[model samples]
Target chain A: MSRVVVDVVLKPEISDPQGQAVLGALGRLGHDSIRSVRQGKHFVLEVDGTPDEAELKQIAETLLANPVIEDVELHLTKD
Target chain B: MRIGVLTFPGSLDDVDAARAVRLAGGAPVPLWHGDHDLKDVDAVVLPGGFSYGDYLRAGAIAARSPLMQDVVTAARQGLPVLGICNGFQVLCEAGLLPGALTRNSHLHFRNRDQVLQVERADTAWTADYAAGQRIVIPVKNGEGRYVGSPADLDRLEGENRVVFRYVDGNPNGSSRDIAGVASENGRVVGLMPHPEHAVEDLTGPSTDGLGFFTSILKAVVNA
Candidate 1:
């Protein structure tokens, strides 16, 4: 079995109130170097075998992330 | 006709949806999220609530439930389906409708009586009103701001898929004041407002939302 990690993120143009709130908290904690912070979803999928990148991209685009408001990044990770 | 109202874990409006269906002269069928069957309902209603406890994202978890697969199939086949509040979020997550409902830009959960204008009256759930007709209904949600791709919004506008538009101020920072939207075929509708909460005068709000339920009954009969 192979493991694939999918990272889903909101587009830059979309307003992320939750992320902004997190940034506010970070500022309160004295993280001066970070100007902005965006939140995203991460999913690890157990695949049948070593699936090709196309298959992973297809799964991310079609099911894991909504293309209307988010983008996706797929990578293979080891156990 | 029998209208199916699906109840997911944490659902708060299934009973109200079923009541509205019965009031609209249709038999109300209770459907469950884990069930794969729809029981041959004439229409389906995804009622409001914090499904999956709004985990991951609002309605994101419940949208992928087994019952939603059947609802998606029926919706594609032109079954009248209404998604209210959290259900609207589920519809977008399920890809049965375009656009996504993000957290309100104001960073607050808004609950109030809202007025909306009917953008298109030909849809399965809006035929009871005239185009541009305004009605007051209850609007409530934390993540009700509607966001969509620019090109897709243009396409929806060009094709008249924008079913309901906010008449007053934008309640949740939704683009173009969009309160609700319909599928291109007009059989599926997703709105952030709690129409089921305003179906009757006894509930306090105007009975304008009853039109949504009645329209679906009429559509099923005509079909």
Candidate 2:
């Protein structure tokens, strides 16, 4: 068995209000040195056998993230 | 004329869209997201609401539905299509329109009556209104802000594809105060405001939204 992890984040140019809110909360909690916070999504997929990088990339690009505004990264592991 | 209103699993505004069509003197056909058929309707309307409970993204899942495949194909061929609110997000996700609607810069769900200046009156859905006319409609959403690369935005402006621009004040911090946009051929339009909710004077902020439905009827007749 193999496991695939996909991480999706809004492109740097796109504003993330949720992440900004989190940063605000952190500031209120006295984490003054942190300059930025950007929110994203994480997905874990379990496959029956070995995971292919190209197929996983296709999945991430087609469904996991929108290329127009978001970037995606994938990591695979054997189980 | 017959106009189709799509209903996804969590769509909340399909009924309202149909009512708007009826009020505008067009027959409204109900379409299902799970179906591949478009029922040969004259035009299509993707209504608002949190489809698939807005999983992944606001309109991500719904954009990949069976019906949307047909919609994307038909839209490219110059079919008149209107997308409202969540439907607007779906249009962007489906690549029928440009730019993506993101969370409001203020990070809040905003609901209000917004004034918009009509920039292009030639689109299938905005032909009833004169250029530069201002209309009031209901704007409601958390992820309604529009974002795009600077060059793409410049290109859209160069092509005069921006259909509506928010006046009075920008509600969700949309770039250039854009409230709506049209496809290159002006057959497809997507906006974050609920024009369907504004078709009736009794229930809406104004009856201005009836023009959207009426415009499409005229577009079909003239086509």
Candidate 3:
């Protein structure tokens, strides 16, 4: 079996209010050293055998992430 | 005229959209997201809701549904389409319109009576209103802020494709205060406001939203 992992993050230019809110909370908690925080999504897929990188890329690009406002990175590993 | 109102699994305002169509003197045809047929309707409306539980992103899953493929094809052929709130998110996801609706900058679910200025009344969805007309409509969303690259936004403004702009104050921190935008041909329009809810004076903040439904009727006639 194989596992495919995908990370989706907003584009650099796009604003991440959730991350901002978290950063604010962190600052309030005395974590002022953290200059920034950006929130994103992580997904894991378990495949029967060897995971196809191209197909996973298509899934990440088409459904898992929006190209207009997001960037996706995929990693595969043997289960 | 027969107007099609698409109902996705989590669509919350399909009924109200249909009611708006009926009030505008058009037959409202209910369309399902899983179905492939459009029922030969003259226009289509993607209503607001948290489709697919907004899993990957708002409007991401629903935009790839079977019905949206047909909607995209028909919309490209000059069929009039209106997307309200989450529907507007779907439109952007489907690539029918430019830019993306993002999370509100304030990190809150804002629901309020928003005033919008009609920037371009030439689109199929805004023909009933004259340019510079201000209308109050209810906007309810957590991720309704519109964002795009500077160059694309400049092009959109230069082409006069921005259909509506926030007038009194920006509601969700949309870039350039853009509340709605139209396709190049002026057939497809997506706005982050609940016009369907404001169609009737008895329930809505104002009846200004009726113009969106009524404008399609005139657009069909003129086409």
Candidate 4:
């Protein structure tokens, strides 16, 4: 079996309110060293066989992430 | 004419949507998320509320529900579809509309009356209103900000697909001050505000929202 991991984040130009709130909270909690925080979604998919990158990309673009405001990176997390 | 109102498990405004349809002199057909058929309704409404408990992102799961397949097909075939709030998220996720509704820029769940201008009066949902007509309706949601690619935003603006625009000032900081949008063919519309909630003067800030229902009724009758 193969596993696919996808990380979806707001496009660099788009504003992320949740991520900003988290950054603010982190600063309040004294995690000042972290200069920036952009929250995103992570998903792991276990497939019956090695999944093709093109197919996975299709899934990521069409379902896992909204292309209008998000960018996704897909990786084979495990084999 | 009959209007279909899909009621997912967490749908909070299906009844209200149905009520609006009835008030506008159309039969309200109840549709379920588990079902695949559209029940032959003249038009369909994906009402507001936290469907699928808003799990895995608001409207994410509901957009992939079985019924959406039929909804998408019908919408493409020129059947009128209106999505409100969470319904708007579902539409965006299902690729029925442009843009994603992200968290409000103010990082708050805004719930209040909002003024909007009818930017495109030719859509299936806003035809009753003239272009630039101002209307007040309830806007309520945690994730209501609209975001899209710059090219897409420009294209939408150039094509006049922005059916509604925030008046006075932007409410949730949506791109281009957009409050709602219509499909290229003007057969589908998705908006963050709750028009169904403002259909009655006794229960809401104004009855301005009745135009949405009446517009659909006119479309169905004219068709």
Q: Which residue runs does candidate 3 get wrong by more than 4 Å?
A: none
DockQ of each: 0.65, 0.88, 0.81, 0.76
Model 1: how far residue B86 lies from native, Å: 1.7
Sequence-dependent TM-score of model 2: 0.98
Winner on lDDT between 1 and 4 is 4
Error of 2 at B152 (Å): 1.1
The candidate that wins on DockQ is 2
Write the residue-wise lDDT of candidate 4 on B1-223 in tens digits.
9899999989999999999999988899999999988888999999999998988778988999999989998889999999999999999999999888988899878988999999988888888999989999999988989988889899989988898888877878898899899899999999999999998879989999999999999999889
lDDT of 3 by residue, B1-223 (tens): 9999999989999999999999999999999999999999999999998988887789989999999999999999999999999999999999999999999989889999999999989999889999999999999999999999888999999999999999888888999999999999999999998999998889999999999999999899788
Write one digit per residue (lDDT tens) for candidate 1, span A25-55: 9999999788998999999988886778887
* DockQ of candidate 1, scored on C-alphas against the true complex (2 decimals): 0.65
Judge the docking of candidate 1 as incorrect, acceptable, medium or high: medium
Which is better, 1 or 2, measured by DockQ?
Answer: 2
Candidate 4 docking category?
medium
Count of clashing residue pairs in every prediction? 0, 0, 0, 0
Off by over 4 Å in 4: none
**What's the C-alpha lDDT at position B96 in model 1?**
90
Ranking by DockQ: 2, 3, 4, 1
Q: Which candidate model has the greater TM-score, 2 or 4?
A: 2
TM-score against native, each model: 0.91, 0.98, 0.97, 0.95
